[model samples]
Target: MTKLETAFAPVAPAVDLDAYFARIGYDGPREPTLAVLRAIHQKHPDAIPFENIDVLLGRPISLDPAAIDAKLIGAGRGGYCYEQNGLLKRVLAALGFQVEGRMARVLWMAPAGAPPRPRSHMVLAVRVPGDDAAWLADVGFGGCVLTAPLALFSDDVQATPNGDFRILPIDELGGERQVQADLSGRWSPTYQVASGAWADVDYEQANFYTYAHPSSHFTFSLTAGRTTPTARYALKNNRLTHRDATGALVDQRDLSAAELEAVLRDVIGLPVEPDWRPLLEKIVAWGSAA
Candidate 1:
């Protein structure tokens, strides 16, 4: 094992490859080729969604590979960045891909002059053997998740199943990279990736802050997102919104409490837990009072 792999070995267990494949409905090749990577990347988010229900419920988020597998795959539940990309990290490694963990500060939807956020988002740097360029494989970014891998250093626009994205140099020294997406003719920053690859400890610390910190939005809001071949779905509180592949709004509506439950279960494809109702109730009630 490589030093990075050895360092992460203890905490990272081999994912249930068969179960994961079945969950994503992916029957493609298992090689670490770009084609295989693209296929899996596209299918993962379509199957497993991005959500923060556990955080909102005041439950601790565990980064153990086994724990992530049990909750996300076994229970058919969705999770936030740490859980989503962390699980993907193992799955890709098991498939013989040279996958490394990376961190990013989210700039998506932030005010123009707001302070920089913490490095709470998790993304993957994947090196396909014999491929000269590294590919950014992230299926964790909500609302605007990447459905296909993009060349890590490329500044040109790259198209995916969901939308168009580009990674541009943000610093004069070229130490920082910014990920942007074309949202209806307007390019918007999603997150800025730090220079080096992240270690296991980095994920643990970031994951903790993302779920536990008072300033973290995950603690208070009910958010879930997923992408399909044709459209993207984003749900916040009692509102569910849908956008087309071109990043144009297709349809959006406020969902009732019962409708929220149904949408979480059916639309978002999460195996809704009974205990989540009280939290969901609070979300609906909060929205009603607003």
Candidate 2:
């Protein structure tokens, strides 16, 4: 078997590549660049959950393509960017797209007009046929990420059911790229991209830090998320918040352990293992104490 196939060979819940494609609403021949992005986004808020369950359980996050495939495709789990986007790079390459794995420093909106800080994030640069340039596609970020690939230079408005988004060039970092969204006209910073090339091993080390570091948010919160056509659901620590299409706060609640697990399985569609319960309890207790 090829390296890519072997990597995903152990994927459980059986990916059913055809069914998975159908699940994502794609029924056409592969477009290489477009198909991979669409599948990830459509499957994303469904298949891979946005959760930090593994970290709270003391499990190491693996950046291996096969390992990620097993966790996400086999076990029906969701992961953060390193795991989500890393595996996506492999899938795109396997499908014959011109794929480059790139890293980004996250510079989201801060409280006091401080400069955007760097957080380890990953995205893909895909070159498509009949197109002179590549596009930026990200399906891994929990919230406020793109559902479709955007042209690199054009300032076109790509409208999602939720809101409008645009990609613009950042000259401060020597022609680096930044993705901005209409956060009520505030133009919030989502992520910063550059022309740097990255490899699987590079992401492996970064994933280790985010999952294991005391300062990383994953170490403290039990979070899971998925995006819907009209709203976004996220479980952060003990509070569950739902945001509507106009970026309005729709609902919020505190969940018990059983409720959390049910949401993980039923709402996010991820398979919950028996061991995850104890971790969930610990997270709940931690939240209650804090």
Query: Which tens-of-lDDT digit does each residue in 80-99 have in candidate 1?
Result: 88888888888888888888
TM-score of each: 0.94, 0.83
Count of clashing pairs, candidate 2: 2
Lowest summed lDDT window (length 10), candidate 2: 10-19
Candidate 2, residues 1-290: lDDT per residue as tens digits?
A: 99999987533222245544544455656556566556555555545667778888888988765677777766667888887776656656655667677788787645666866555888888876656677776777776656667666666766665667777877755768777777765677687787767766677677888999897888988767877767777777767777777566888988799988887788766788988888878777877887
| Deviation in Å, model 2, residue 147 alpha carbon | 1.5
List all candidate RMSDs to the true structure.
2.2, 5.1
Off by over 4 Å in 1: 1-12
Model 2 bad stretches (over 4 Å) = 1-27, 33-36, 113-116
